[model samples]
Target: MTVASITDLDVTDHYAEALHEVIEAKAEHRAPTPTTGEEKTAAPVVDLMAALEKSVADARERRGESSGGSEATVHEMPAKPKKKTAAKKATAKKTAAKKTTRRKTA
Candidate 1:
């Protein structure tokens, strides 16, 4: 099969022109109009985080209980959570401890 470039394809023909016009009309008809109101607010970041955490915990619990043999157990197991780099965890712990100290002082 030959790959034709834009220059190689003839767009001057009546069929091509008619097809282009039809496509333009269809696109204009289907185009979404801009809305003139406040956009809907998304759920809070903390709510999304909580949902993701709950899903991970549920998956872990499900994998722990299965009595089926190796293949079934392997299929049922969720993908492992991405391991946090030790440096990242240490930085997070330090920030959290600082916050706790601030709360105590306050």
Candidate 2:
């Protein structure tokens, strides 16, 4: 058996037709009739992140763990002196000591 081409297939856009009918009904201030036999019902919108967080919280609760409410402590590192500055201070101290020794010897 040969397969039918897409051009030969009869396609009907039920959604577009339904939407157009609804728009026209609203303009005429009348309730739109059901375009298809089945009535469309909207599913509840869910927040996936919130749901996952709640699931994790529930699991933690079942395991006898508390929902973490503590704020994280951030540690700030002290700034270090530059290598050149440290080296200069060391050389200055060494020269000062040498000068004192030379004066004592003299």
Candidate 3:
């Protein structure tokens, strides 16, 4: 007879086994996994919407506008691409190639 605390109920061997059994049973009864083709088709729309919403929220926050929700306003700087000079680009390419070679050999 082991005394179990509330937290112990979640962490003990008996509870863990029970949880695993429940998860396995649920997984077995669930529908088949969606095909990669279906995922690829739907993923872009979701990603685009998410990116747009994030951009709007970021723009609002930077201008000190409040969101109607309980979430804190997160100010984000607009992403600017680095202006690469010929010298910098050559140095970067050399370093990147060196890194790849070292990784492959290691």
Candidate 4:
């Protein structure tokens, strides 16, 4: 009675049942049940180089750069101020502790 959306993976009831079973098994602290033959098939292999190239291309296009990597320039981040030394921090803590000790002793 249910119609699958175009965006839905072709998996149907098996996917839902498998997901539910896995969730239950995980909740019970039990090992996952073995997948059926249909589920045993390997997922499509990814081309890392191609994917990276595509991502870079898309990013460059968004930033108004052409496909050529070298011509693309990135904006520089503003420099942050350096933190005070550990010695300064320790001295501040020691000063506070000395004041606390004097108050307690008095």
Q: Note the clash tally of each candidate.
A: 0, 0, 0, 0
| Cα distance off (Å), candidate 3, residue 85 | 63
Off by over 4 Å in 4: 1-39, 69-106
lDDT of 3 by residue, 1-106 (tens): 3675655665546556666767777889964433233234444446888798889889888989885555767899999999987665543445444344344564
Cα lDDT for residue 69, candidate 1: 27
- The lDDT leader among the candidates is 2
- Which residues of candidate 2, in runs, are more than 4 Å off? 1-4, 38-106
List model 1 lDDT by residue over 1-106, tens digit each: 3566766877556566656767777888864433355579997667888798678667766889543322433446788899887665543444434344344563
By the lDDT metric, which is better: model 2 or model 3?
2
Highest-TM-score candidate: 2
What is candidate 2's lDDT per residue for 1-106, written digit by digit as tens? Answer: 2366765778788889889999999999999996447667999999999999899889888999887954458999999987764445543444434344344554
Model 2, 73: alpha-carbon shift in Å? Answer: 46
Model 1, runs deviating above 4 Å: 1-46, 65-106
What overall lDDT goes with each candidate model? Answer: 0.62, 0.79, 0.66, 0.78
Q: What CA RMSD would candidate 4 show?
A: 12.5
Error of 4 at 10 (Å): 23
lDDT of 4 by residue, 12-53 (tens): 667888899899999999988988655476799999999998
Using lDDT, rank the candidates from best to worst.
Answer: 2, 4, 3, 1
lDDT of 4: 0.78
Whole-model lDDT, candidate 1? 0.62
